[model samples]
Target: MPSEGEPHILAEIAERHARIGREQLALLRAIGRLDPEAPWVREGARDLPHLLAMRLGVSEWKARRWVAAARRLPELPGVAEALASGALSLDKVVELTRFATPRDEAGLIRWARHVSVWAIRRRGDLLERAPVREDRRAQRDRRAEWWFLQEERRFGLLAHLPAAEGAALAAAIERWAERVPAVPDEDGELPDLAARRADALVAMAQASLAAEDRADRPTVVVHTRLEPSGGPTPGAELERGPVLHPETARRLSCDARVQVVLEDGHGNALRVSPVRRFPPEWMLRQLRYRDRGCVFPGCGTTAFTVAHHLRHWSRGGPTELDNLALLCSFHHRLVHEDGWRLRRDGDVFAWLRPDGRPYRPGPPPPAPAGPPRPAPADRPRPALAAAAQARCAPGPAP
Candidate 1:
């Protein structure tokens, strides 16, 4: 970037790319028109946004935004001209026209040359509600609520509350937070208001959970498998989520009911007199103990796992432990639907990518701090120079 003559070249390249973007937007506008005109009907897409999303490999919201921007572009000659001349970007055009009127477009476009998207958004009273008339469906789809995941524990919550509900939650949080005096932390300082409110929320949730009986909770399904390969010990699987570490699955198994099925050497189901709908409780327990959890690598989920057959049952695979492995629902689907394969070794499942190459995980992280290994014993302390001292004291150089 600091090289001489680079400025001119970079600017020219940027201009060319921007011009290309302008032309691309124009073409996108043409495609946008066909969307409402039902051009994708034969393509089996449910609607224009669906078609665009599939074709562009983008989210529905993004596809809708681009389509809407394209539909509005014809009416925005000034925006079109500036875009064509590369004076502004498609993003700037979208934000500008999100609220600006034809009379204001010229000045806004000129002003936009100097400001950021957020700055332009803050400049409008109409921008907030402009899309209501232009595209009521898209505007209505946007929710006021928020959702977030706490990744450390793989817990997440989604909230799609309306204005009233949001306000109620806000008020309750504030009230509960104010009810308790801030406890002194290690630094002898009280937590801030936000932290206090967060704590109150957790307390509220715990109180609610405490009101319910544990027996009323739903059952968790865990799958366990022993790998034939000399990998890590057997692992746990969740049917719909990640795999669980073996230790975690074992800990959970202590309190949960279990059912297990055995696959024979071939991977076919063995017939029992009653057709044994579920595996024997004892067998399930043993499976859990042996495999620990889902054996699929890196899944990190312990509950709701399903036992899988390394060889498909329809293909005449046996119905005993040798042919069975534990898998989460997602990876299980990959095998059944996406052509990915998991070959079982002694204790490890060597995963294979759909393209037929082995799927190796990245390098393992460093081990945590633990007891240090023992070293050789220290030598006994040397005898104090007794002999030399004795010789010197005697004044005779022996």
Candidate 2:
């Protein structure tokens, strides 16, 4: 019933698909063999997953799966063989590695070939270990701590919860996060789910404070020198918190209820001024209308954004519409606290990174070609015996 060349064409297609599988296996093995201290660190990648994401043009989630599969391939010869032979796919192998032991990999390969990738993943989920029975030790281990990093001017929360309570808390945060409007990330993509959860937690805290009826909400008192005889007063100090960078102080002062206090070198207040908002209201409304959302490329968040002064008002910068730019909280922090710099050139704004390079999204250009590399083998073997020998190598008897 088939045409004469149809079978040949189909056979060639099959051959190439199998060849691709073998190539993927070889790539995974090489990734596995990479030294922990690879050159990716120097390029600003935090770890292997980040490096893979940047260099290979893949998502961090996908890179993590590749790294995980590569690490286990050295122990699963049968699984590697099936992948190389195209009996199983890269997705199937990645899922299998989640729970497949070397001894059981042969059986899994047989089962995987007859089923869909989803089926294999479902089976992997089922095979993963479940929570242990809660006991006194588990209850005693539960803890939550709030810590601050002075140098980074960052705060962190760490918690260890019992499985039941942790699940409940996670579900609550997830539900609340759904109510929080989604925002675009640095790359202009929808924000990471983890970030939404963090925002949800902050929203919960804000809601708790809003319930209390008072003459005025609690205020954060920042001690700053109005007169900068030097280049700039080093920074402002929070009443009970760590010292804030000058840029951070300027950002807070932009739309805040600011009460300026002229203090002497002896720490006595010389004059106290009435509290007032910077830029007033009409100018802020016009600035918001002109910029709508964050002016940072790709970030279009309209909520929780502030008007940033192109030049600090403290240094004789004008409080005019031309001197303002709308920025989201994250990007504002980047411009102020982080070493990123932003300036307007005519109607266009230029963003510069810590190293003074133009800030641009997307991965860097690929490195130049080097010497031709060796091709991968069709059938690779695990060095089980060699590993065992090295672990039990003979030494002087103790």
1-398 in candidate 2: lDDT tens per residue? 99999999999867755755666777688789876457543333546776665555454456767788889998999999887887887778888888899788888888999998789878876877655553454575465545457899987776667767889999989999999999887888997898999999999889888998545423446675645462335777655567788677777876666665556555566676676666667887898788877777555446567878888776788878888889877678777877677898888788887789986555443332552233544444223212222232222101
TM-score, predicted candidate 2 vs. hidden true structure? 0.51
What's the TM-score of every candidate structure?
0.41, 0.51
Pairs of residues clashing in candidate 2 = none
Error of 1 at 318 (Å): 18
Q: What is the lDDT of residue 389 in candidate 2?
A: 20
Error of 1 at 148 (Å): 10
- Summarize candidate 1's per-residue lDDT along 114-194 as a digit string, tens digits: 997667656653457544464554344433222234466444333334445567988988888887668889999989987
Lowest lDDT 10-residue stretch of candidate 1: 389-398
Looking at model 1, residue 331 earns an lDDT score of 51
Task: Count residue pairs with overlapping backbones in model 2.
Answer: 0
Give candidate 2 regions above 4 Å deviation.
1-13, 26-47, 54-57, 129-221, 226-232, 247-398
lDDT of 1 at 120: 68
lDDT of 2 at 388: 21
CA displacement after TM-score superposition, residue 180 of candidate 2 (Å): 21
Candidate number with greatest lDDT: 2
